[model samples]
Target: MSETSPAQRRPSGELEASVLAALWAADGPLSPAEVQSALGGRLARTTVTTILTRLHDKGAASRSRAGRGFAYSPIQDSAGLTARRMRSELDKQDDRNTALARFVSQLTSEDEQLLRTLLDAADDTPQRPGTGPQAAP
Candidate 1:
């Protein structure tokens, strides 16, 4: 059997990301066939369906019946998804404060300042009871 070429092989998670991107760009949920077409000819409809199923299983995407096939949509926008992933990684650490400090330390000065500004703004904003990261506990 011939091996797949490097160009044909995708980096791990790239396909799922592509599928999610397509869903995010679309105005509404997309069927597997629609996702495959939106991704061009690189992925098969079955593969798209599998990716959508995996995403749904992980709660990254939501699905509903669209004719005989299912339509899928991203549960969160791209930035929201990335933030959730970051929070998840941070939550997994034994020493979360140290993990966060290290992460903050590595940020560019501009990003650091932006973070500070965002934090300050958050402090001023009226927060609803037991909402947001600060209220997790």
Candidate 2:
């Protein structure tokens, strides 16, 4: 079996993610059929609607009345969705040690070193009063 499941392999529900990305990239909400067509015939309008409904249930999409149909848009952008997905994955693994071990084992040498450096830098830096960096004065 592949280490990554299909759920993880794909960015999100293939049709759902694509439709949400399209809506996010667009100026406004899109109808289900419009989203299906935007995906280049890979999925049906009904499937798109199902995906949209699922996203709505998950709080990742919001639907607004548009004529007889509903227009849908993403609640979060691509990066936000990705972070949520990663967090979901990590959350599923209850053991902190196991999670860390899995993450470390997955990283390449360069990435591991980069993580080490970043962790070390964070440890060395002291937090100041304000959120932004201290003034040069």
Candidate 3:
């Protein structure tokens, strides 16, 4: 992975995913200045602007002219974005089920038992009420 820049680093040095997260969680569009104010960080206004423009270019945000500034809204809300990202990651895995199985197998005994219990519970759970099985006619 490429080194994260100061402008893109979170309080914990992770990439600035939370900034995009915040904008996506907001109820309406926001200018870069508004984003900066909402972030309440040491980041320069330009840094926030750069991040927002990058998001727009990546198709993550929609931008519209608002007088001299551009108002940006998240193209996908936070939940949608998270689902998209999760699906994308799963797609990139060669064998997602196998990976999960290996991870579960490698867990401590207690954790492994917990995983088995959870899987058993899931297997015992019934399908949705209106879907799948129905009573015999």
What's the ranking of the predictions by lDDT, best on top? Answer: 1, 2, 3
lDDT of 2 by residue, 1-137 (tens): 55356777765556666778777877878898888777776676777898888988887889999998899988888889887977888888879788989889999999999989988898688877664346445
Against the reference, the lDDT scores of all candidates come to: 0.89, 0.81, 0.76
Better of 1 and 2 by TM-score: 1
The 10-residue segment of model 1 with minimum total lDDT is: 1-10
Whichever of 1 and 3 has more lDDT, that candidate is 1
Model 3 spans with C-alpha error above 4 angstroms: 1-15, 94-137
Q: Which tens-of-lDDT digit does each residue in 1-137 have in candidate 1?
A: 42358778878998888999999999998899889899885776778889999999988999999898889989999999999899989989999989999999899999999999999999889889888777986
Candidate 2 steric clashes: 0
RMSD of 2: 8.1
Model 3 lDDT per residue over 19-114, tens place: 686686678888888887777755677888888888788777889999998999888876787768667777889999987677667899998888
All-Cα superposition RMSD per candidate: 2.6, 8.1, 7.1
Best candidate according to TM-score? 1
Pitting candidate 1 against candidate 3, the one with the higher TM-score is 1
